[model samples]
Target chain A: MSGRNATIEVGATSSALVALIRSEWGKAWSVRAPAACLAGAVLLAAGTAFTLANDQVRAMQTGEIPVGTLVPVAEILASSVMFAQMVVVLAALQLVTPEYASGQIATTFLSHPRRWVVVLTKAAVAGVLGGLTGLLTGPLCVAATELALGDAPRATVPAAEAAVMTAGVFACAAMVAVALGFLTRSGVAALSVAFVLLVLTLAAPAATGKVFPGVAGSALVSGTGDPYARWAALLVLLAWVVASVGAAVVSVERRDA
Target chain B: MRIDDRARRPAFRTFVGTGRQSGPVIVVPMLQFAEISKRYGPVTALDHVSFRVEEGTVTGLLGPNGAGKSTLMRLLVGLDRPTSGSATVAGHRYRDLRWPLRVIGTHLGGRPVHRRRSARAHLRSVALTHGLARARVDEVLELTGLADVAHRAAGGFSLGMGQRLGLAGALLGDPAALVLDEPVNGLDTDGVRWIRELLRLLADQGRTVLISSHLMSEVQLVADRVVVLGGGRLLADTTVAELAGRARDEVVLRTAEHGADDRLRALLPDAAIRPVDDQCDDGAWRVTGASEREVGLAARGADLTVLHLARETADLEAGYLTLVGDRGQQVDSVEAR
Candidate 1:
C-alpha cells in the first residue's frame, strides 16, 4: 500500500543510545522476574536483620550475653547488603538471558546493529536498577533491626556513606552478573555461577580468616578492613566488572546474531 | 546486468512528504549483492551470487527449500555476514546504516515476537530504540489490521495473526526498501490477495520490494521480475514472461485417419511428434515445432479430418520445473559418470 506522507528522520547516535537505554529499562521491568527479585531481596534482608537483633536483645535481657557485645544496627544493615546483592545478581542475569532465550536479541540487534551499544545499554540499565534497589533496601534493613532491638545500644555508621557504599557494591555485582549473562547467554548457567561465587565469597573469610582479593563482600559489608585490603578488594571487583564486560562486548560483536 | 541511475530513484517521492532536492539526485540500487558467498564450515549456503534490486519494482526470490533464500536474506539484514564479497543497501552495509529501519524494513520467517509482550508494547519498545514517535506505532498497528488486538499478548495470536504482526513490524519505519521472507505463509486466501496488492502498491510507489517464496504461481502473479535459485546456485534472473517464453510450447492435434500420426511426422520433419491415446475414436499427436494453423493445414493435405488442434502455452510452473528438474538430472548424471 502507499506509505503515509510522513518521513522519519534519523536521530543522532547519542540520541539513539539514549533511546536504547530507555528501551532496555522498559524491557527490564516488563517482566515479573526483576520485581520479584527486588521484593525477595528486601524481605530477606529485613527478616535476617530483625532475627539477629531480636536474639541479641533477648540474650542481654536474660543475662546470658553482655550488652557491650551486641552488634549495631549499622553492621546488621551492612551485612544485609549481601542479601540485596544476591537479588541484584539474579535480576541482572534475568535481564539478558531471557532476551537471548526468546531470540529477541535478533530484533534488538536489528534495531540497533551496534553490538557494543546493546551490551552497554543492558548493563547500564541493570546496574542502575540494582543500585536503586540497594539504596532502598539498606535503610529498610536498618529500621527492621532498630525496631526489633528497641532501646539496646545500636551500632551506627554514617547513613550517607553506608548508602553510597551499598549502592556501589550492588551496582558492581550487577555489572558482573550482566557480563556473566552475556558470556553464558543462559539464565540457569549464569544464575548458578553467581550463586556459587556469592556463597564461596561469604564462606571464604570465616574459613581462612581472610577473603580472596577478588571478593569485595567482606570489605563492602564491614567497611573496617585495613586500607590496603579494602582498596585491593575494590580494585579486584572493579577489574572483574571491566574484564568480564569487555569480554562479553567482544564476543557479542564478533558472533552472528 | 546493470541498472541505470535514472531508473533507481523513487517514482512516487512526491506522494510521500519527503522534500524534493534542487541538486542532481545520486541514484543507487536499493539493495545490491555483489559476488556474495556464505559458508557454514564445510557446507556452503550461497555461492558467489550476484543480483541488484532497483527502486519501484517487485523482485521475487524464487527458490525451493534449502536453496539459500534465508541465508541470502540474513546476509542482507546483517544477521549473518557473508563469508566473502558484500551486501549493501543504498550503498551502505546494513550494520553501518545510520537509521536501519528508516532505510530498509525486513521481516524474516516465523514469529519473532516476545510471547509475553502485548503487540503494541512490543512495537513501542522497538520504536523507542530508533527514536521513532509513538504515532508511528499506532499507524502500523492500524495498517496491519492489528489495532483491535493491539493490547493483547502476542502469545495468544494465531499463525495468520503472527504473520500480520511481523508485517506490521516491517512497515513500522515506512522504509523505502522492504525485504520479506515468505510473507504469504499461513495467510488465508484474502490475506494472500491483500499482501499481493500491498506489495504491488509499494513497488508502484518507487520502493524496492524483494520477496522470497517457493510458490511459483504466487510469484508469477505479483513479481515484475523473478530471480530463481536451485541448489544454492543462481539459475535464472529474468521477468516472469521471459522465463515462461524460454520454455517450449506444444500444439496437440487429433485426426480420424489411422496413419495420421506418421503422416504429420513426415509432413513436419523438424517437429517433434509424439502419439497420445485419449480413449477417443481418433488418436492424438503432440507437435512441438509447428504452429496450430500449420498442423491443421497438414492434416487437411493428408485428407485427414482433424478433431482437435490447439496450442498449450508454457506457464511459470512448467518453466521453473523444467529448469530445476533439468539441473537435478545433470547433477545426477555427472555423479554417475
Candidate 2:
C-alpha cells in the first residue's frame, strides 16, 4: 500500500520460461516434502547398500555361498532405487498436486497465462530434482557397499552404470509423477495412480517388464531381455515422458485450473 | 522490430483509448471485460457480462453469494476460459501477455500455498518469476504487516495471516492492476481496516484495483465504482453515489391538521405520496421524489402545519438489495454445478 512507484524492469523474449524454471528451482528446494524425500532417499540408500554388502560378506564367511563371490554393487543400488522409488514418486506428485488441492493453481495460471509453460517448467523441476536425488544417492550407495566388500571382487556393469542409470530411471519416474499430478490434480489420486503403476512394473516378469510403464528406466540400468534392447527401452521411457507432459499441457490449457 | 527494454518493462504499455468523453483526454480503463460468457456444462456462470474499470479507481465487484462475482474475476485472470468473448488487462487478453504478473496482480483466495513454505519463500517464488528484485519481497511483507512472521511456515497461519500472505503475493510484482476476490473473507476488524486503506492508497496511486466482496457495507466504504452482478447477469455498474441515488428519496411527515393529507396530495399531484395508516393515523404521509425541505416548503405553501419531517438515510446495501431482488437465486443453482 506504500505510494512507492511500481518500477519493475522485465525483458520479454527470454523472460517467461527461463524465469519460470528459475523460480521453480528455488521453489523445489524451499519446500519441505522434496528436501525430505531427498534426505530419506540418501539415508535408505546408504543403509540398504551397507546391509546388502555385509550380508554377502557374512554368507561367504559362513560358506553359505562361495567365498570371493563378487558383490553385486549395481544390483544393490538398483534394488535401493526400487525401495526409494515410491518416495520419489510422492515427492514429484507434491510438485503440482498440492497446488491443485489448495486451489493455488489458479494463481499459478494467473501468473503465467500460457498454461503450457507452467506445466513444462514444473515437470522439468521434478525431473531435475529426481535426477539429482539419484545422482547423489547412487554413487554414495555404491561407495558404501564397496567399502564393506573389502577387496571382494565387485560384479557386473553396476560399478560403472549405477549412478547414471539410477538417475535416468528416477528422473523419468519423477516426470511421470508430475504429469500424473496434472492429470489427476489431486494428491491422493495421483499418488494412488503412480503407486499402482510402480507395483505393476515391479511385479512383472523380466520378459514383459520392459513393456511396462517404468521398466525402461530400469532397463536402461540393467538390460531388457530378448526382443527389446536398452535403446528401445529408452525410447519407451521417452514416449511415456512425452505423453505425460503432453497430457499435462492439455489438462492445464484446455481445462480450468 | 526491437523495442527499448525500459519502455517494455511493465510488460504491458497502457493502451490509450481513442474513446472521448467530454474533455480533451479520454479515460482509459486498465481492466476490461467484454461480453464474457462462461459455462460449466449447462450452467452459465457468467452470461455475456461486460464492464470496464477505469484507471485510478477502486471498483467493487459486488454480488450476493454465487452471484458470478468470483466467476467474473476468475475469467478476468484467465483461471478459466470464457465460453465466449474476452477479459483483458491493459487492452490485451491475459494469456497473450508475455509477463502477465508484471501487468496485473491477482489473488483469488490467497496463493493456496504449501503448508511447509515460509511466507518469505512464497513471496520470493513469485518475485523470481518476473525477475523482480529480492528486496521487493521484504517491502511487500512489511507493507502487509507480515514482517514479524515472515519466516514462519504458512501451515500454522490463521485466516487473517493467510489473507495478508495472499496480499503480499499480489503486491510482489507491483503490477499496474490488482484483482482480488473476497479479499476480506476472514480478516478481523483491524485487518479489514488495513486493507480498506491499502486499496484506497493503491487506487490513489493511479493503480486500478477491482475487489470482489459480498459485504455491501465494506464495498460501500472502499469502492468508488461498483459493478454488481446478480444471477449471472450484469445488474448495476455505476459510481457509489449514482447507485445509491437509484433508491427513492423519502420524506415522512405528520401534519398538525388532520385534513392536511388531502390538501398536500392536491398540492403536489405528481409526487408519489401515500398515507402511513394503521386505520388511526390520517395525518402522517410518506412523500417520494422530494427532499424533506421540499416537502416542508410544499406543506407551508399549502398552509398545512407540519409537526414532524424526516428523510430516511440512503445506504448502498438497501440500493443493492433492491436492485437484484429475488433474481440472485439463480446464482445458487449455477454455483452448485
Q: Residue B105, candidate 1: how far off, in angstroms? A: 0.5
DockQ of each candidate, alpha-carbon based: 0.34, 0.39
Classify candidate 1 by CAPRI docking class.
acceptable
Task: Give the clashing residue pairs of candidate 1, or none.
Answer: A72-A155
Give the per-residue lDDT digits (tens) of candidate 2, residues A1-257: 22223433333456677878887888888878888987887788778878888888888889997877767666676676767777888888887988877666766776676788888889989898889888877777888888888887877445446777777778888999999999988889888888767656767777777566656655566553333666886788888889988988887788877
Fnat score for model 2: 0.56
Q: In lDDT terms, how accurate is model 2?
A: 0.78
Best lDDT goes to which candidate? 2
Error of 2 at A173 (Å): 1.2
> What is candidate 2's DockQ?
0.39
RMSD of 1: 5.9
Q: For residues B204-263, what per-residue lDDT tens digits would candidate 2 score against the true structure?
A: 566678999878888898789988887788887889988787777678998887757667
Give the C-alpha miss distance for residue B136 in model 1, angstroms: 1.3
